[model samples]
Target: MIQQVFSIVVPLFVIAAVGYFYGSRVRPEMRITNQLIMDVFMPALIFHVMIQEDFYPSQYLPIMLAGVLLMLGSGVIAFGLARLIHLPWRGFVPPAMFSNWANLGLPLYVFSLGDAALGAGVMLVVAGNILCFTIGTYIYSGKLSSLEVLKTPVIVAVILGGAFNFLDIRLPLAFDKSVEMLGQIAIPLMLFSLGVRLTRASWKDSRAGVIMAMFCPMVGVALALLLIELIPMSAMHQNILILFGALPPAVVNFILAEQYQTEPDAVASMVLIGNFFAVISLPVVLFFVLSN
Candidate 1:
């Protein structure tokens, strides 16, 4: 078990560590790279997975529902916590609600659980992206639009991909291979960009950040445990849900915070500190998950 844990965890952190070293030393401009990731690489990855001949959307519906419920459950708890602590709902709730699924989740699941689990993991990410763009955007910007959600590249990829899967239409091998190659770039770039983002993070709101850093995952895992008791799912889905619950706040949380001017400092602290805490938290979750 220890060896399995190390095998899964070590490579991820080593790549991230290299990114951190490069980011701190080189401080390369990441805006274009980040845009390309969101607009192209990630969508290609999602589309590639969704359009695979073996891909069956219905098989993973439970996991997708679990992901939605997890986010909503976390949001409810975060709302209560925000009111209790006198923190702005916009500042605390979104980060608490959205986990770092895209960056940490895809690679972690693919590495630890193997290729069979990748579709389920991608489904979880798609579910999160839907909510993050619509409901989560509403929380930050005070408006929601179906058109706005549809305009997102990842959302478009998911919709089209699901359609192709549902209709059992496989793309030609040459085209499919091309898309797969583009998709493959996303995971490593995601980990590397994560490290770059971390280098720019500040520790201004350490106290509140620390509290939220712990609070976010606690609420998620607790809700996941309760949901697993009530919901009958496959072992793979259960493991994915638990790991999803254990994930830290999304780095996009800080991006949105900065964009909307909604306590970016506190959000940044929560994002950075929460991720740092994941170094300890993820292994514990993995131990329990793998034991099962």
Candidate 2:
């Protein structure tokens, strides 16, 4: 079990470490790289995965529903915690509610659980992104950004890919390979960018960061436990749900915070600390899931 966990976890951190070391030394500008990933690579990956012969978007709907519940439940709890401690809800709740399902969770799932897990992973991203754009955006920007959500490349990929999947349309062989190749760049790039992003983390809000670093996974796992008791799902799906809960705060939370002029610093702190802490939290979660 330990070997299995190590095999899965080490590769991720090693790549991230490479990115970290390089980022620390050179401090390369990442805006264009991040933009390319978002605008091109990630969408290709999603579309490729979505169009697979075995891919059935509807089969993952239950997991997506669980994801929605997890986000909402986390937000509710975060709201209470923020009010109790007098932290701004705008900063705290978004980080607490949304999670790093993309950069960390996607590759982690595929590594630990194998290729079959990709569908569930994609659906989970869909659920997280939808709420992040709609409810999470409203929390910070004071307006429902529904249209903005539609404009996102990832979401557009999901829509197109899902439509193609449902219609049983296959891309021409050469074009399919092209899309797959493009898609392949997203996961590693995501991890590397994550490492680069972490370089910018300020410890100024370390207390809040520590608080959430601990809270996010625990809350998610707790919600997953509750969800499984109420919802019937396959064992793998159950495990997926549990891991979904254990994800750290998404880096996108900080981006959104920055865009909305919210407490970007605090959000950055929470994101960075929460992800670093995931080195421990994820292993424990993986052991629990793999053992079961």
Mark the regions of model 2 whose C-alpha exceeds 4 Å error after superposition.
none
Off by over 4 Å in 1: none
lDDT computed for candidate 2: 0.91
What is the lDDT, from 0 to 100, of the residue 286 in candidate 2? Answer: 94
Query: Which lDDT tens digits does candidate 2 get at residues 215-279?
Result: 99899999999998888877888888999899999888888898998998899899989999999
Best by TM-score: 2
Tens digits of lDDT, candidate 1, 177-236: 999999999999999999888888769998767977788668888888888887788988
Q: In model 1, which residue pairs have backbone atoms overlapping below 3 Å?
A: none
lDDT of the candidates, in the order given: 0.87, 0.91
Indicate the worst ten consecutive residues by lDDT in candidate 2: 56-65
Candidate 1: RMSD over Cα atoms? 1.2
